[model samples]
Target: MVRIDDLQVFIRAADNGSLSAAARQLDLSPAVASAALKRLEAAVGAQLLARSTRSLRLTVAGERYLEHARAALDALQSGSVALAQDRQALSGSLSLSMPSDLGRNLLRPWLDAFLQQHPGLSLQLQISDRVADLYRQPVDVALRYGVPEDSALVALPLAPDNRRVLCASPDYLARHGAPAAPQDLRRHSCLRFILGAAVHERWSFLRNGERQVVTVDGRWHSDDGEIVRNWALAGLGIAYKSRLDVLADLRAGRLQPLLEGYDTEQTPLYLVTPHRLMLSPAAVALRAHLQQCLDAYLAGPRAGEGRNDSCD
Candidate 1:
């Protein structure tokens, strides 16, 4: 049987990226921490961690073993909570990662409310448009779009989101005349998102239950959603983007949805984390809070609802 204390030390060391830092947090000396790691590795009969003067890295076996180890630890902690459910109070750290556009618009307010409710917990929020790898990052939870391919993590559906709409300002439409059909877009200027540019530069449309992919060329491309959005606002070109993200602008007459009939599939947004049987108090709290906010937002009226020139 693995000693819980030893496993805890190993996890803490891995998380902190240093044995000394783990020792400091656990209130143990570096020597004691080092010895604990050695014992833990010996009991497992595999080299779990690679040690060097400059860096600590997980061996291939270590990487595989770490997943099970974390799950086991979580189960144990959760069991204790279940046993003491009547008297337990949540107090721990929660690290989260999210895509920038969603992070700014959807998650910010929920986070604010979560912090107010759980004053004792600590949170670290990392925002980036680039997909974050949960294995490489030490976050407890993440809010992400698109389905995750990692089998080691568990993804929970938080909200329904999908195919971004192609949109532009009315001034742009008046100046460049609206393309009545997807085929007409080939001649129009487009603003493209950089993440999947090679694959998504050509926009997609659906017709009579049939799918058609259009390879669109544009004078401008960016990885930043906000930047591409701003370009659309300036009447530069048509931009494909999330409905929620563009709803406000569409309502205010700053932007117009170019084609509404083509979007057939919607992508689901998710709350994800490394798979574990039991989640900590902070993680649980945040997940619940996010779902609550999502439900409320979806039920409300669309942002910027009453624009003068409409493209619904």
Candidate 2:
């Protein structure tokens, strides 16, 4: 008979693309993991994996069985949770992916507090600017800043009012006078942010119900948003950045908003998951916790009172 542990081992092996890696993750010996897979294949009466010395590939039968196996496991987990008398104590591991800037500057404290609240829970965080593949990567959820382009994923909004703001330090503005309008940014030193191979030099704004795109240039650019913010803080150049990223600086008078009359396009934040039903109890709890924290922060009294823009 195929055991639940065997199914779990098979699923982990499929996800990692290596039996040894799966065994390591599950704290099982390689021989035991191999035997589990063999027993699972025999019970199912089909060859699940095509194994070689160097690699392993899922057979057609394995590919079809994998989805069902995952669904069954999820259902079992949900049912177990439903039957449990103590639902407040959540115990499990959650893996998350997020941008480097938000992960370090914003979410780090929030996550630390969350971990403190749940002693039984553990977390694995992957910080990178690149968007992670939910289906292929070893992440349960991703906190992203824009609308998801993938139709297969489910996106839950965390912050709808989040937007990019054109900002510069007081010293920089004093030295080179803030741009009076979006078009005037062409002559100013605008720090550019690069993602992958693309340079995000085109800054967009909306004024009087009309949209405009201004192509700006700068002497320095970096792929990391945090670096760009640091440059802006040092009075290097103007930067078009997310308000959440520069909120504290703006409030403290280190950075001042530019193009105040013109509103930038909204880039709402989202908590993305692979599937709603596939979400573990730990993931669900974290999602709610994040939403509450973000909402409270955005709705606080200091949220909208920090702009020192003279243009508006």
What range of 10 consecutive residues in model 1 has the weakest lDDT sum?
303-312
lDDT (Cα, tens digit) per residue for candidate 2, span 1-312: 779899988887887689998798678999999999999999999988898989998999999998888788778877865654255687878899988877788778788888888899999999988889886677889999889887547798888779998999999999999888888998999999996789999889998889999888989999888999999999999999988888868877889998889989687899998665446677777888887777666654453554322111
Q: Model 1 segments beyond 4 Å from truth? A: 2-74, 80-89, 196-199, 302-312
Provide the overall lDDT of each model, using Cα atoms, as 2-decimal numbers.
0.75, 0.84
Tell me how candidate 2 scores on lDDT.
0.84
All candidates' TM-scores? 0.72, 0.73
Model 2: residues >4 Å from true position, as ranges?
1-88, 301-312
Number of the top TM-score candidate? 2
- Whole-model lDDT, model 1: 0.75
